[model samples]
Target: MAKRALSVLVSGYTFLEGLRWHEDRLWASDFYTGKVIAAGLDGRVTEMAQVPQQPSGLGWLPDGRLLISSMRDRKVLRREPDGTLAVHADLTALTGGHINDMVVDRAGRAYVGNFGFDLMSGAPFRTTGLVCVEPDGAARVVAEGLWFPNGSFITPDGRTLIVNETFGNRVSAFDILPGGNLGPRRDWASFGAMPDSDDIGTLMAAASIAPDGGALDAEGAVWVADAIGKRIVRVQQGGRILEQIDTGEQGIFAAALGGPRGTTLFMAAAPNFAEHERRATRLGQILMAEVDVPHAGLP
Candidate 1:
């Protein structure tokens, strides 16, 4: 297939992280602002809710409730329609690192990731892994030895779960059982390296590592945030780099399948953390774009 092009729809955000298309609006998390913002097709932004701790991932359950990952609190929360947040699951005991991103299945099972260690300070810590949270809130670690697991998604057929290991610079897959257990882990795709001529070195920066969030397109291509690269990469099922969508920003965090027909791709881009602290960029901006393909998996 020919490579699909990505056109920017919108920009300017403070460390955007998670992206979800609910109803007719596009919803996302602002990591630094601790708030969720909903964007309409007309480009209107509305405050959805405020999360006390930093928010990273977002999902919805079968019951129509919103699931939010409170990265700092080490817990998954159920946000009711009335604006109250309940403890969906506490993951601190199960995960050695901080929760990062997640994907919820049709049965309401949420597969989540962790930071693995202190990235900013370059501190050593135990390797992180993926955890499965049942609909009733019970949770367990299903895979380990991952280096900063970030964006993830379940295949449309519901047979495979793919997760991006940020620090490892690779995407991994797992066999999905009926009861929510992941098995037989293996590499799915790899983002080789920053151009050798660039000064960032072999590893991408904190926002890079295929960062915060991603979504699958109709052709089964994985559209990853590629945060550190300041772009989005479309990876096919066979591990091929199909296309790259540059957001024209330093800290591109997450992307989602949204817009009128679900073919439009919405990205959350922001200035670097240091730049944000210096008031050099707006805290939260929803960058918009339209892609050639539609979303493959559930929104």
Candidate 2:
């Protein structure tokens, strides 16, 4: 991997996450702004939907409707062709934690993850589960005992699903069984073992890797936004760091491979994830860099 400067696509966002490329547009959710946005190559921005509680992930259905994760409310909102937002799936009964990010499969089944603990309040670590929501709105927990499953991506063939466990310091892979259930699990990459400390500050300081949001490339590699490392990394199946881009002092919470040929790597950057501090300023931005491989698979 080579070190280089990333170009700024847009600025003045409160906080951005869940970046994706669809229908020639770049979509993402701005947590503090409470809006899901779409931007073009020209940098023109559009508000696609509003998520009052907080939005962290974005995806689309096979029929072209949009799916956005409502973080605080523990629900997934669907945007119809007419632009009205409605409860697509309710995940409240599946977990005691808040929902965070998701990846909708080709059949319109969505795989979602959660916070596992009260992050903003500094609660100790609590294991969480991943939920699968059918296209018709049925929901169920498919996997359990995960440590903060934050970002996810499905392979081009839709046979494998890779999820980034932020606090777990690894990216886990699962076989996508028929009807959206997860099969056997294995570590696709492991930066280190789970931290020994339960305290947030101690765990963060001692942690060597924290894989955040991610996107898959055509070459079967995943580009990850490592929040604690303050950089984006390309990882292979056996935990290899093939490429890396330093983000200087900023924290990259999420990333997506976009652009006409899908060679553009888009990153959501901020100084930190503090809610109050992010809402107080507009320092968040959508940063971009060119990569050799184009994007592949689900967002």
Candidate 3:
């Protein structure tokens, strides 16, 4: 396979995640910087919102409002039409650990995921639940016992939702019920079998694939960032690798499809995902690579 070159669009960030292409700009959340930013293709950057609790995932509701995942505080933020950032839903009492990523459906329902265990504290592995925050701010556990549900996307038809189970080394799919609840799940792709131990260190070492954030293309294929492999791969149904881009030294945390004609693939690359290392140095970058398939799905 011929490794393609990546062009750096922007740098000098602590860590970038939760990328989305909307309103002719690439929107992202910087973890350590505690801000949500939008960047143009010309490398110009604009600070959109300041999240003191740290923002992770980014999405938009049907009414054109922005919903952000406040990671540490376990809340979902909403940018009102008047430009005020307020708590739309609080999950501090609902979730076990930090909130990470989310995808908002057409009906304005936000599906959110959490860390499940304290990664900073080095706690043992504990499965967590995926909750759906309704437009009215009501939340409920939709699914439980997920091994670290990270990046997620809803299919274009609005019927299926796919989420990256990082530690589980697989991607899971669920049917989006009419009332915003998730149906029984099926393994979309499994890179390797899961181990028996419920330890973070053991699971991390035993897994063969660490699928992180992902983006959906027009053809229903997903481009997923492999945290452990330090690369991005375009995968079809049943785990067929179509194309891959080796990120070289940088470990890609997230990926998004954007740019003119939706042919550009944006990657959130950094040395590592550790909070201490990422905050100590501003080495995070948004790298771009042109691909054949155009984007055609929700955030």
Candidate 4:
């Protein structure tokens, strides 16, 4: 496939976290600001709802409600039609670490993850894998001992689930069993070694490589937000980097494929996370690129 260049859609955000395509709007989250926003196809940004804690992931329920992962509270939330957010499930007791990103199935079952360790303090904590949450608020740990799971996506056939191991520098695959439980874990893709950095501790660059989020394309390729590399990479199913689109910024937290034709690749980028803390800059922004391939599964 031919490589394409990235284009800036808009700029000036606090800290872009999640990117999703729902209905005619592109939904996203600003973790630092605790705000979930909906951007129109015409580039109009509007506030959808605000959560008390950091919103990490976005999903839709069978009833058409919005499902969100509240990172700080370690819970999954549902936003009703009246714009009220309610706790759908509390995962504190099920997960050994803080919840991160998630993916929900058509059956309304959500697969959630934990940091496994503290990211900000560069400290080692507990290791928790993946958990499956039902609509009724029941949860079960389906996988374990993953190194900081981040972005995740289920295959169109609903037979496989792929998860990005942020700190581990790899993507893992599992069988989607009955009732939305994950089967045995297997390595899907692995980045050999992490880049060395003095400022970011002995942290593996591979872990933070695809830090925040990513999406799957129509050709069965995984489009990952390579934060450390300041680019978005399209990886084939067999683990080859097919294309790379540079962001020209530091922190590229998340991405999605949306637009009128569903071929527009939307990237959520920002300067270094530390920069947001310094001046409270609206540094986070959403950028777009017209790719030849369209997004495969739900955005």
Candidate 5:
């Protein structure tokens, strides 16, 4: 891991997460601020939408409608072509915790994950599941027994899916079945053995790599936000760290690769991830660095 020269694209946000590069701009859910914002390389910024219940993951329907995860309400909101938000799916009965990151495929199926426990209030650790919501608003649990499934990615061919288990210290991969169900789970990258603990703090303390959120690169490696490591890492399969961007005092939670040439890497950075710290001070920023490989696969 080497310190690299990073550029600040924009600043003043309250905990940015679920970042994605789309349509020549980077979009992210400023969760604590309850806003979905978009920013471009030209420095233009826009408030795309607002989610009162707190927005997390973001995706798009087949018809180009926007899908936003309303975390507290346990629902997925679809921004219609006319800009009116509609309830796409209610996941209250399916998920146990606050829904977070998600990735939608070409066919408009969203793969979503959650916090898995009462994070801010401090609850015991529990393995959660990954959910799938169809274009028509049908939803179901596609896979189970995940340790805080945070960010995910789908291959461009729509065959493989990758999920980052932030507390599990690994990235998991699954095969996409013909009908959108996941076949089986396997380790795409294992940083260390799974912690035999039920406490969030204990689990994090034992983790060698907290794979939080990331984007898949053209070379098949993932640019991951090493949550507890205070840096952004490019990790290859089987737990090999290819590169790292030292974020220093700032903490990175998500990364996106985009720009005219797709070489600009954007990160959702904050001083720390504490809920109180973010709400009390809007120190979140979007940081950028240049990478050799362009982005590939669905966000």
Candidate 6:
């Protein structure tokens, strides 16, 4: 059964990802356009910054400067108060693949993830590490051996970090130590055992859900965009689906709960995930729905 139909909040984007609700607006990165934008419910859109190599994830520092993931260049760019972009953290030597999504705590500690392997080139799957960039701009690997870590969230108390392992068929969690280092990992939500195949097609087929970008609700539940299921689903801690919104033809890549009342659920959708295919058209859209719970946790 469907909870509700998704209405188009905004459309004509190349491909939207890493969306967040901040300061009464929706912020996101357009992969192909290389532009990080912010949109309001009134249909107004603003360009925040541009990353030449491309932008995927977004966050904010304690001083209010914006941080964006420069995917291809393997770097995190910071937008200064003057609106100029500068290098905040150089991850070229710390990561193996193109940098992907990121989550930043109140103290400005950023945990960024990567692809682990080349999917566009059809390369075999490889495990990767998660890099934690400190408030001083220093970076190091806090955890490793992850299978395509994507969306992430820091508990309001800043004690636990939960990350979705897209190809692992589970959401892994860790304790956020005093210095931002992570403790041993545990399965916060497991759809099934981790897939053992190296082929992307085989792994996708064996998994129950490929969780992508997501948002945490005030009730401690997460709304995850199911890349394999082509829908938006609310997930509990133990892999239970609390609510689901089916998208007949659109493929969702990101989710966010925002708006005046904080009940508006925003979803980023497209026809497909093919980079080349999306670059040729602006069919990507931001879909909106309503939920009972408001948002909580860090970006």
lDDT of each: 0.75, 0.89, 0.91, 0.78, 0.90, 0.90
Tell me the tens digit of each residue's lDDT in model 4 across 61-154.
8999998888878989899999999999999888766687788888888889887656666565444689899888899999997767888998
Stretches off by above 4 angstroms in model 4 are: 1-5, 193-200, 205-208, 275-279
Which candidate's lDDT is highest? 3
* C-alpha lDDT (0 to 100) for residue 90 of candidate 5: 93
- Tell me each candidate's RMSD, in Å, in order: 3.8, 1.1, 1.0, 2.7, 1.1, 1.0
Error of 4 at 172 (Å): 0.8
TM-score of each: 0.87, 0.97, 0.98, 0.91, 0.98, 0.98
Would you give me the overall lDDT of model 2? 0.89
- For model 1 the local lDDT of residue 39 reads 76
lDDT at position 119, candidate 6: 81
* lDDT (10s digit) by residue, model 1, range 58-99: 889998899999988799999988988899999999876668
Off by over 4 Å in 2: none
Candidate 5's error at 117, in angstroms?
1.2
Total backbone collisions, model 3: 0
Error of 5 at 285 (Å): 0.3
1-299 in candidate 5: lDDT tens per residue? 44567998889889999888888889989987799999988767899998999999998877788999999988999987777789999998899899989999999999999887899888999999999999999999999999999889988788999999999999999999998999889999998886688888899899988888999988999998988999988999888999988888998999888998888899999987889889888899999998889999988
Residues 117-179 of candidate 6: C-alpha lDDT, one tens digit per residue: 888888999989899998778999999988899999998888999998888888899999988
